[model samples]
Target: MSDPELATRLGAMIRDVPGYPQPGVVFKDITPLLADHDGFTAVVQALADAGRDDAGRPVVDKVVGMEARGFILAAPVALALGAGFVPVRKAGKLPRETHAVGYALEYGEATLEIHQDAIAPGERVLVVDDVLATGGTLAATRQLVAACGGTVVAAAVLMELAFLPGREAAGDLPLTALLVVDGA
Candidate 1:
């Protein structure tokens, strides 16, 4: 399918739950899309293309997926890009030495950690996730990649919240999303 059709299909699969984890917040749930093989593959392929160079060759050395849902989306993207997959998880989840970064949330603070040895110095990395909301998680993931001495080439996501400041929060890092929706 074309990009517009792909976006439409993906959007159709997302179910909105009002006031989910907290009141007055609508969570865009992706469980429905995850269950459909075709939908899932399309997302992976679309995201994987973000790591390619101008000539259509893979340019990333590693693909870092931010915890939880991110892990699910990024692994296959890494394979498609011919890069290694790394996980940026919540603090204390990794057993080995890690580089952690703390970021602010709408209400509080949180930390994300990545294995210290995950990336070699100067390696080009592409960070991937299921969604880009406030961008705190993504920025923290960028920090973790830098701490490991890797250069973040770009950030990819299934979707991004246009109402939030995710792009600004991510600084100069290029971010590509399959869909950009207002709010949740």
Candidate 2:
């Protein structure tokens, strides 16, 4: 299916839960979509397509996924693109020599780290995540990629909280979201 069509179907499968994890915060829960085989495949394929390199071969040398949720989709994307997969985790999660980047979130400040040898200089990278809230995580991930001498080719997410300043925080990088929530 086309990206738009797949995105529309995927969006329909997501459930919205009001006052989740906190009062006044309506969470866009994707469990329903993730549980469906077809939906999950479509979502992953859309993300992979979004980050595809223009060259005859896959352009990205690596795909960097944020800790936890990012792993679910990123691994498949990396395989689809024929690129290596790297994990950007919270501090102390990686045991190897690492490079770290710090950033502030809506709730608190945090640090993310990637292995020093995850990507070589001038390698192309694509960062993947489930959602773009404040963009802190992704911005920090981008910085981590740069510190490792890798170039961020693009960022793709399943959902985007448009009310947040995520796009502004991401700067000039390519950001694509399958579904956008106006006030989430």
Candidate 3:
């Protein structure tokens, strides 16, 4: 389906919660969409399509998903694309050698780590996350991928908090999101 149409449908499935985890934070909850098989399928398909390889094959060697929400979507996209799934998680979560990168968030600084062997040299990777808020998490994920000698093919998300400067911080990377919120 076209981006706009797909976005409309996906947007309909998202629930908005005010003051979640903090005051003045309007959280865009995605549980409703995750529970709907068709809605989830459409979202995963769209993300997988966005991360397609150049030869039209599932070119990504690894699908790198961020902590928490990212894993939900990335694993399915990895399976659909026939690629291996990797997770960039918080510190002390993985029981293996890891490489970490720090980035700035709205409130403070945060760090993300990926297994050192997650990606080998020249491996193509696609990073997936549920929401792109401040770009800090995604940017750090990109750096972690590079540290593992992986080439980031693209970064895809279910939604983008466009009010934040995530796109600009993401630089020239191929960033694709199913839905974008202008002010949320």
RMSD of each: 1.2, 1.7, 1.3
Q: What is the lDDT of residue 111 in candidate 1?
A: 88
Model 1 per-residue lDDT at 183? 52
lDDT of 2 by residue, 1-184 (tens): 8767876887789888988867877777888988999889888877887667565467688998998789988999898888899999999999999998889976668899999989999999989999899999999998888998999989999888889999898899998888777865
Model 1 agreement with the true structure over 61-175: per-residue lDDT tens digits: 9999987999999999999888999999888899999898999764458889998999999999999998788889888888888899999999999988888888888887778
Any idea what lDDT model 3 has? Answer: 0.89
The TM-scores, one per candidate, come to: 0.96, 0.92, 0.95
| Residue-by-residue lDDT tens digits, candidate 3, 1-184 | 7889999998899999988868888888899999999889999998998678556678788899998999999999999999999988888899999999989875568889998998999999999999988899988998999998889988899999999988888899999989999976
Identify the superior model by TM-score, candidate 1 or candidate 2.
1
In model 3, how large is the Cα lDDT of residue 3? 88
Q: What is the clash count for each candidate, in the order shown?
A: 0, 0, 0
Considering lDDT, where higher is better, how would the candidates rank from best to worst? Answer: 3, 1, 2
